[model samples]
Target: MLYQITADGLVLFHLSFILFVLFGGLLVLKWRHLVWWHPPAALWGMAVEFFHLPCPLTDWENHLRHRAGQAGYDGGFIEHYVWPIIYPAGLTPGIQLGLGCVVLLINVLVYLRLWKWRRTD
Candidate 1:
């Protein structure tokens, strides 16, 4: 029972993190503290994609599923839950590199804005 509860919490946190990465900038616009958070979160998101690494959350989910005698997916959560909606097929290295570039570019822009804002003040 304890393990199940912990697994459920992990799943919830994982889902929320996904949402935050996608919509975080919008949230940052309202809460400036969140702006400070954007770069690291963005980096982590891109790293996961670029490296083709399984997120710890996914591992945790799989472990829980296994414990419950449920089947765990072969691919990452993005491949299982998100790929069908966004990506037509399996993810590739080129796509991963592009995703990483996108993350880096966004952080560059954010830092530029932060510098400019600081200079103006």
Candidate 2:
């Protein structure tokens, strides 16, 4: 039971991290100081998706689940959780790459705005 709770907490944290990677730049727009953090996180997020690298968060979550006597899933957190809800067609390599591109595009646009704002200030 404790393991299962831990696994659930990890899943929540993993999801929150993904959200931050995607939109943390918007926070930077407000906080300004967050500029030092969001870009690298966004880049890492894109790299993981583009390279098809395994996320450590997913691995840790799976390990906790297994320790709790639950069967671990075969893919990353998004594939196991978010993809099913958003894209019932299932997750493919192409889709993963596209998602990575989406992340890159979003952060690029956000940072561009940030740059413009800073210059005007």
Candidate 3:
């Protein structure tokens, strides 16, 4: 029970991190200081998708789930959770690369906006 709750919290935190990695630049537009935080996160996010790196959060979640006597899921958290909601088909390598590219593009645009805004100020 405790393990399950912790695992659930981990999932929530993982999702929050993913969202931040994608859109934290928008937040940084307001906070400004988050500029330092977002780039590394965005880079890590891109690397994870582009290289198929195994995230420790997923592993810890799976470990907790197994501890709670639940069957752990295969694949990364996005494949298990987010992919189904976004697309009907399974995530292919090409799709994964595209996703990474999308992240890169979005962050690039966000940073460009930030740069332009700073120049004006």
- For each candidate, the alpha-carbon lDDT, in order, equals 0.75, 0.92, 0.94
Candidate 2: misplaced stretches above 4 Å?
Answer: none
lDDT of 3 by residue, 1-121 (tens): 9999999999999999999999999999999999889999999999999999999999999999999999999999999999999887899999989999989999999999999999999
Tens-place lDDT digits, model 2, residues 1-121: 9999999999889888899999999999999898888888898899999999999998999999999999999988898999889888878899899999999999989889998988999
47-113, model 1: which lDDT tens digit per residue? Answer: 8877877788899888987786677787777777777899698877787778667766766665677
Instruction: Between candidates 1 and 3, name the one with more favorable TM-score.
Output: 3
Query: What C-alpha RMSD separates each model from the true structure?
Result: 2.8, 0.9, 0.8
Cα RMSD of predicted structure 2: 0.9
lDDT for residue 111 in candidate 2, whole number 0-100: 89
Q: Which regions of candidate 3 deviate over 4 angstroms?
A: none
Backbone N/Cα/C clashes per model: 0, 0, 0
Q: Lowest summed-lDDT stretch of 10 residues in model 3?
A: 86-95
Worst 10 residues of 1 by lDDT: 21-30
